[model samples]
Target: MKRRLLLVSNSTLHGGGYLQHCQQQIQDFFGKEVKRILFVPYALHDRDAYTKTARDKFKTLGLCLYHMDVEHTVTATVIFISDVLFFSLFPGYEVESVHETPDPVDAVRKAEGIFIGGGNTFRLLKALYDNKLVTEIKKRVLEDGIPYMGSSAGTNVSTISINTTNDMPIVYPPTFAAIGLVPFNINPHYLDPDPNSKHMGETREQRITQYHEELETPSVLGLREGSMLLVEGNKATLLGSTKARLFQRGKQTTEYEPGSDLSFLLTDAQ
Candidate 1:
């Protein structure tokens, strides 16, 4: 699969506007060829507002944004509501919701670029599974050479599983299986044990280790805030000002400094 992805740890930094930090990088990632973007706003609750927020951001990158299939919606009178189980895309226009289409699969095949926003990993996975978009997304990003972008929970779903996510089990999904766009899992917003905090809680490392003990999950890249992963084909590079920590069972936990070649992390040691 020849995949191209820009998976970010978080959307905003302290006091930063939405996607303000990565706007240039995002523009570079998708390149000038992608003029339209098929947006997946499932990870958010207020889908319309979320799409609207992203629309402004994507406009900065010179990309027009369109959202996906769902039931119930946000309008003038209703503020917050959305449902799932469909997909749709058309030419030279935008759809209000999935009600416009009877066939969702064929619609996805025409996608050129896709973006998945961040919020709840479980909910995102559940929506993908319920709507049967998992395979279609994989086909688009992994096989069809569509450029994909995700942040936080969006990045979480790109991994092998969402078991390492910090979100609570607020809702039940059919399975913990994620889109597996990448070979391993990711622990976004991975915090190092605070050097000064007196609060005695399981550190993020310990939490991931415990998850590994039970699940024996694949390697996990602990993506700190302000960091991101840029993948082109089989090569994955760590970008930003900070180092990203890597965790694998029976292997030394290591922190890869920015600009360090991270393509090795995409494959196991020889």
Candidate 2:
């Protein structure tokens, strides 16, 4: 099956609610068929608390969030190996830790939709590798045609590698390799160079330049604030008012406008 993904640059815009910017587009992506959501809050520090807050956001869009098996009845049991999450029995529609589930991967596979929250990219990748859930999530989204959405650091993981991310490496993961759900990489929360800046720090563009020098094969897209990439089947379009920057190896970096044809941006990396 073709991949169905939504990569958001950022979840909240300043004073806006969590994911309030893309709520309409997000709801439209899953539509009415999606009843359950596999919320992966590994990126954030307090995943348990985040899960409760995340469930509330889903409720705002008139949707319930929970993960269940194929039988339609909630019966799977959870046992968390760490205190990161508390396990809960599948008594009814409720939010719990991903690792707490009996079969973490299987639960993800069975869910109608998957939601990955934004936080630290390194910590998130480490958690995924630790729990051996990287492959399971890939199988569910890429093969099963499940709807997936991620913002900021969450969006960075959707690509082949997290090399292009703007976050610091607070924790070292097994590898810089990510989900590889998308063919290329993304630098979310991309800040354009300011003409009046006199500070000595390198701009976002300059930093990405350093990244390109290291791995020139993988293309990187700089997703600015409030911008997102909505992928349907083979097509990936830029959704929002602002434009996005695209950096290709040995090619001049170009800016992609909103509503423009972005079907070719999803091509495989060289």
Candidate 3:
């Protein structure tokens, strides 16, 4: 059986329309027989950040959230710090709190569909690799042919490496380390037409351009909040009203309109 991957940007069950769009995308790809395994490394905000109401709405289509993390040499220390500072500061929701000593490869092997949530892509990538779970997740996708999904940090980590993310550089990520799940780096919430005066920041498109110049290897895909990349077997198609912008090495940027076939991108990535 072939697995389908649904890579989402940041999603808000209460505000953003992306959540409903994500549900439709998931249903379009996985159909009625789907099981969702969520990986929330950055769910530091709340234990049940992905609320039961949201999970239950999508659960009808076989959605489930698993507090999955790569337990390894590095995660041991991070988990300790997270437990003391992160968990103590805010105590209400359910935190998975997996032990650092246990192997993470087992978790990746059991998952059929993986959803990586937003926040700190670099730290998440480092934790995954240090725990030896990154290798297994790749195997699950490339070798086992399972569906690999991402959003925000999840989408950013799927690239060869994401040098630029929207958030501040709170942690220095391991250089050139990532899941390599997707050939292109994704800038979610991309293309902010207007600028905010309070924050000193570059627009999403501007940041993506800077990343392309720095890496000069992998291409960058700019996906707006509601847009997603749908992959089945070796084929990929763009879903939603938004268009996808592609920035390749030594090539002028071009736009692929919505409903256009994206089989070429998938072929190159594979």
Candidate 4:
């Protein structure tokens, strides 16, 4: 089984609809075999609305989209009058149980493809942890060789860690660790410094540089808008209309144009 990944910098371009800019790339990557995609919409607050948006977009691309909703069920068995008294004493306490229809683990196992949308990275990762889908997703992508697509925050979680994402940490996961689908880290929607602007803030490059100040940090790829990486097996190729910047510790940042081979960054030595 060969690993396949399509990591997009942004789901929508400046003037495009949801996933419109990269529809062809997605279709090509998944090919005709993948007719259905299990979508992960945990990044945003409104799961129903987010799922609808992604489902409609994927429909246009000839793929059916589905999502798993974790359901909670409470079952209270009062075998005796004393049990009711016990419950009254412990106000607001009940025998609660959490379950999901078409279990999330099984959904990933049976998915023809997987697509993770963009939003707050922290929220998405936290949800993944809560649902215990991180390991399942990794196994499906790495072992089963299922095609995995990620956009923005989705792309961030595919790497070694979500530490380089531009999103604020609205929630905390078990750890900053990610799925590690790719050996390195990614900074999606990376913006270049505006030489003419008067704003006094650190540039995207400077922030990634600061990440390198720590020991044992992996290299980070700053993916510009409209850019993506197509990884097949051990080879990773840059795609789309823009170039990407590579940030390495103790080294000058290098720019890679579309069609550049970035397989070198997939090594453990990075």
Candidate 5:
């Protein structure tokens, strides 16, 4: 099955309510057939609050949002044996094992749609690893063709890796690698350099250029606020009012307006 994804730059725009900027696109993407959506809100510190916020927004779109909190237990077994050669001598061996409840993985398997909210990229990716949902989510979206939606950090994790994310590394994950729902990397909430600004720090474009300096790194798409990418089968189109910037190694950065075709990003080649 072809992968279906709606990767959004940011959930909320300035002066806009939560997900108000792209609400229509979200509803149209999921459509009426998908009434229930499995939401992953691990990016924020308080999962409950984040889930609640997302749930309320999705509910307005006529969809029910449910989140999963995986619960598991670890058990250790100790075996004691007596040595025949030496009387009163004892040796002990300990083994550790983990057992999981079927709820978490089962939820992904049965989910008709998945929505990952925005926050810190590191935290989100780490939580995915901790809950062992990376492979399960990928299989569900890529193989089962379930509709997938991501915003900000959620969008970051949808790419090949989170190297292009602007969020600080408040936490470390198992690796920078992500879901690879898309072949390229993404820098959400991308900002343009202010010619009149006094700040001397590297601009977003400069940072993306530095990323391109790496050997064989995939292309990076800088998604500005209020911008999103709609991927359907083999076609990917830029959506919303803003324009997106594309950065490739040894090439000039290119800009694309809304309605532009971005299907090239789906391929392995840069």
Candidate 6:
């Protein structure tokens, strides 16, 4: 069976519509057989709420939820054990939580589908690369047919390289070597309606334009809110209401709507 990679702009558990978007896509694609595993590294503050809410939402969606241990292996083990106990003692499905020890390379490789939660995607990419898990994750997606999904940082990491991010640049260039699952770089949380013009920070479009000019070779996709790219096999198609703008070095700047071909940028420099 072929696997599907679903990357979101952010973890939608905290009221962003991204999570809901992910749910709909999964439902549409996998239907009742959808199984989700959330890789959370930054949801410590509201751990309980996030977990309960995710379980409830998936239940409503008629999907099964599995959570990986984010910190303190014992806590994760406890959650997994408790779930096992519930399944053994009670009557629901078997939902397990595993302690995320020695990184998640093996686990990611084995999963049918994985979701990279929104937070500091750079940080996640850095850790994955440092631990040498990014390569394994990519191998799983490309070679072994595992469906991988990421939001915000997750979405950014799916690109050839992530140049557009709201977080301060803490990771180095080599560490930012993304999964390259898609041909173009992704600028999530993108915006173009900023006519107000008072904010000191560059608008999403402004930042991407600046990056494009500075790079020796650049191919960028500035994706705004509620926008995503659905990549299958070697081809990709833009999804959602917003238009996906492509910027490249040698080609005329063009904006494409959903269902258009993105393979051109793959051969284009940068």
> Whose lDDT is greatest here?
4
Error of 6 at 36 (Å): 4.9
The residue-by-residue lDDT of candidate 3 on 96-209, one tens digit each, is 222222445676676655656676766666666666776777778777776666777777777666664566666665575576666666677676557445766666666666
lDDT for 40 (candidate 2): 87
Local accuracy of candidate 2 as per-residue lDDT tens digits, 76-184: 2221222113212222223445755787777786788887889999999898888887888888889988988888888988889899887889999999999988888
Candidate 4 residue spans exceeding 4 A from truth: 62-102
The TM-score that candidate 4 achieves is: 0.85
> What lDDT score belongs to each candidate, Candidate 1 first?
0.76, 0.78, 0.60, 0.82, 0.82, 0.59
Model 1 lDDT tens row, 1-270? 589999899988778889877775786787656767777777877778887778777764422221221234456113222111111121221322221235445556776777788898888888878888888988888888898888999999887788888888778999998888888888988899989999898999999888768645688899999899999998888987678999887778988987767777677441
**lDDT: which is higher, 3 or 4?**
4
> What residue pairs are clashing in model 2?
none
| Superposition error at 231 for model 5 (Å) | 0.3
Error of 5 at 86 (Å): 82
lDDT by residue (44-150, candidate 6, tens digit) is 23535544544555454432222421353787767666655543443321222212434455666556655555666666666657667667767777787666666
Prediction 5 TM-score vs. true: 0.84
Please report, as a residue range, the 10-residue window in candidate 3 with the lowest summed lDDT: 92-101
Q: 87, model 4: CA deviation in Å?
A: 60
Residue ranges of candidate 1 with Cα displaced over 4 Å = 62-104, 268-270
For model 2 the TM-score comes to 0.85
Report residue 238 deviation for candidate 5 (angstroms).
Answer: 0.2
Query: Which pairs of residues collide in model 3?
Result: none
Per-residue error for 45 in candidate 1, Å, reads 1.1
**Candidate 6, residue 57: how far the Cα is off, in Å:** 3.7
Candidate 5's residue-wise lDDT over 1-270, tens digit each?
Answer: 479999999999999899888876886798757767788888988877777677677766522211111122221111111112221331211111011224667777878888888999999999889988889989989998999999999999988999999999999999999998988999999999999999999999989998988899989999999999999988999999899999998988899999999998887786
